[model samples]
Target chain A: MVLMFKIFKNGWLDIFAALKGYELAGVLGWQDIRQRYRRSSLGPFWLTISMGVLIGALGLVFGNLFASPMKEFLPFLTIGLILWTLITTAVNEGCTGFTAAEAMIKQISLPLFTHILRVLWRNLIIFAHNLVVFPLILLVFGVPLPATALLAIVGLVLLILNLSWMMLLLGVFCTRYRDVPQIITNLLQVCFYLTPIIWMPNLLPKRASILLLHANPFFHLIEIVRAPLLGTLPSALSWQVGIVLAIAGWVFTIIFYGRFRSRIAYWL
Target chain B: MTNILINNLCVEFPIYNSTTGRSLKNHLMQAVTGGLMGSNEQGHVVVKALHNICLDLKEGDRLGVLGHNGAGKSTLLRVISGVYAPIGGSIVVNGKVTSLIGLSLGMDSEATGIENIYLRGALLGFNRSWLSSKVKEIVDFAGIGDFIEMPLRTYSTGMQMRLAFSIATMQQPEILVMDEWLTVGDADFQEKAQQRLQEIISKTSILVIATHSPELVERVCNKMIRLERGALIAA
Candidate 1:
């Protein structure tokens, strides 16, 4: 019980301290984007352009193949792909949150959560860049702006909350076991197909769709944002799943982080 | 007032090599075989970086640490800086601490000298207003001139070090921890750098520096200790 209390304190306090360092994380995150796109004339817009090209091509082939109208299918596919990109990239990069910051971790005494925030914030910037494609897709397809679209912000907040905990957990775990990152990359690759990004969940029969969509947490995460933006309220089930995952994941992460927080620098 | 109270502090590092130590496969195999294969496998190696160390530092104290390579000098400094938490003991630190262990740790080579000033300063916990107020002074002291607008990668090694040194010493920390005495740039700049460093050290409440040069410790420190293989041997 005493050990549990210690772990709770260690994990939560690190997060509280890290919240105060958002400015540091923000600057570092922006620098990461700038550094990656340095000397390129298009800068980070290249993210939007490449994503735009992929969405366009996939929309063309898949829309025709699925025999859905371009107007209806394009917006759905666009939103799905954008949210999927955020989830996949965030998790992939999350695996390296501690290792990539090895220099800063070993030398400085900044809150360890600050590194996790840096990774999330960096991906959010890329997510924002990719979001540019969404507006264009809406404009071209003439998808009417729906009142439910504003809820995407709330959905995004929930999604970010969920991703943050995953990053924290994976960041600490991957630091100790070097092989986990590779395993995670391969798993996420498999998950991309398992989760509905390019394909529509409606394509499956009702029973199969329910089983696949409800059981897979990523589907609920994506649907929370994508559903609202694509002109429908997310099912009550999606919100319930998202909220539960956020709370549960954070509880587990806090305990895991507290137990292992002190060991991260050693692992690195 | 500034104080650093440490008691029976211990730090151990588990060195996980690539082969058997850091792989999930080995761990799973060990679990499957129970204790059967665990004995033969070369598990992770643990290095006791710091052991049963105790020290008390107060305001107006200048403590120098002397040791050869891998004698835990750097680890000791890091523990004080709050980078590595103690595994088996307790440490209570009051007052803000700044470490000049790696002056260029967070600097970005792709960024301009001016941009790196903010980046590195933010890592050191300075807010934007504070950094904005001191940007001109940092630039002037670094002496990079027109190159301040150019990317850091364009700067020569001495120029980069000078800029890093200037940004690192801009704030007067209550507890100043350093790995070594920073002497950088050409002869003229070295004189200026030393003067700046001395000025900061004099105003600092507590100074903890690790170095090999006995002459440096004699010149700068009033109290000194020596560590041999993670154990304090002399004081």
Candidate 2:
């Protein structure tokens, strides 16, 4: 148990040490974005173009299928899809943060959290590219820029915090159990459907149990960001759940990282 | 002030069988089935890579680690570098360390030689401005000429080695840990590399080199130790 305490303490300290290398992490993140599109004319804007096309196509098809008007549907789907991309990209890439950088991890003595930061930063850059469509979508749908829109930044900040913990937690786990990445990929796929991304939660019969939406942590995450962008405050329940889950996730991560931190290098 | 003190350090690695070691699914199955099928096959097998290592070195000490393959020489270097924390005992190291175990370990193959130098430099904890200032010195020493602008994958193995060697030895390290005596490039370049390496060694406060050649131990190192099956053998 004393060993575990030391490991945990070391793990926490390493996280702070990694943060001090934010410049290195940011540079690495930028290098990744450039390397991915090297020699391509479009460069990172390709991300924006592809996302624009997907969102437009999905909005048209799903909007018609659900018999929802375009104005309401586009904003709902747009905000949801954007937040979903941010979440899924971080979660999916987090699984490989340490495993993919096996060479660097073994060779360099830099903080392990630096790798997590690099992953999150890279995904954040991609998310920014994807955001090019958000304002345009609002303009096309005539969604007003309500004062509440400022709160979306707060929601975004919270989302980033959530991703930091998720990446560290998942990165450590996936690095240890090689098959964990495959499992996580499959689970994220299932989660996409279960989350209220494509379909509306209100479509269900009135007075029907709201357990499906209420229980989903993803929904609250989306609501907090999406509701603010749509010019309204998210339900108190959403803010409470999102904040509670963020704290709990980080608490769980601190303990787990502390215990298994030393084992990571051996597992690799 | 550069020193390395390793006291009874131990490193253990669990050697999981192919079916169970690399897969979480197998572990889960074994757990669910109460180990009915995998009780024997999936049993934990741990390799004691290093056992009760005790050593100390101070400033200006050039130590050569001699051992057979899998004798934990590299593992010891890694532990000293802080890449691996000891499971038992402790290792105290003072001064900054530069390890050249795999000189090109973090270099990107698809990136240009210049970009790779920067990448490798970053891995060694050098900022861009610092690496940029040293780029000319490294490029001249490597003598790769115009190939420096080309991607690393286009370079021959020897050329890559020259680049790696030059970049690794460019800075005067307080503690220099190397895996082997690197010999690359033509005879002319080899002579130059040796001269530069010797100069660097003279300035380096501490040197730990792992090698099989007794001649290197005699010529370059003042102290020598041998490892067999992870245990330090008295020299």
TM-score of 2: 0.90
Clashing pairs in model 2, backbone N/Cα/C closer than 3 A = A8-A258
Error of 2 at B178 (Å): 0.5
Give the alpha carbon lDDT tens digit for every residue of A215-239 in model 2.
8788888888888888779999988
Top candidate by DockQ: 1
lDDT for each residue of candidate 1 in A1-268, tens digit (9 for 90 to 100): 8988889888999999999879999999999999999999999999999999999999989999988888888888888888988988898789899999999989998889999999999999999999999889989977777888999999999999999999899989999888998999898888888888878887888888876788989999999999889888999999999999999999999999999998899888
Quality of candidate 1 docking, DockQ: 0.76
Docking class of 1: medium
Task: Residues B85-191, candidate 1: write the lDDT tens digits.
Answer: 99779999999999987788888898999999999999999999999999999999989899999999999999999999999999888999988888899999999
Alpha-carbon deviation at B42 in model 2, angstroms? 11
For residue A140, give model 2's deviation from the true position in Å.
Answer: 2.9
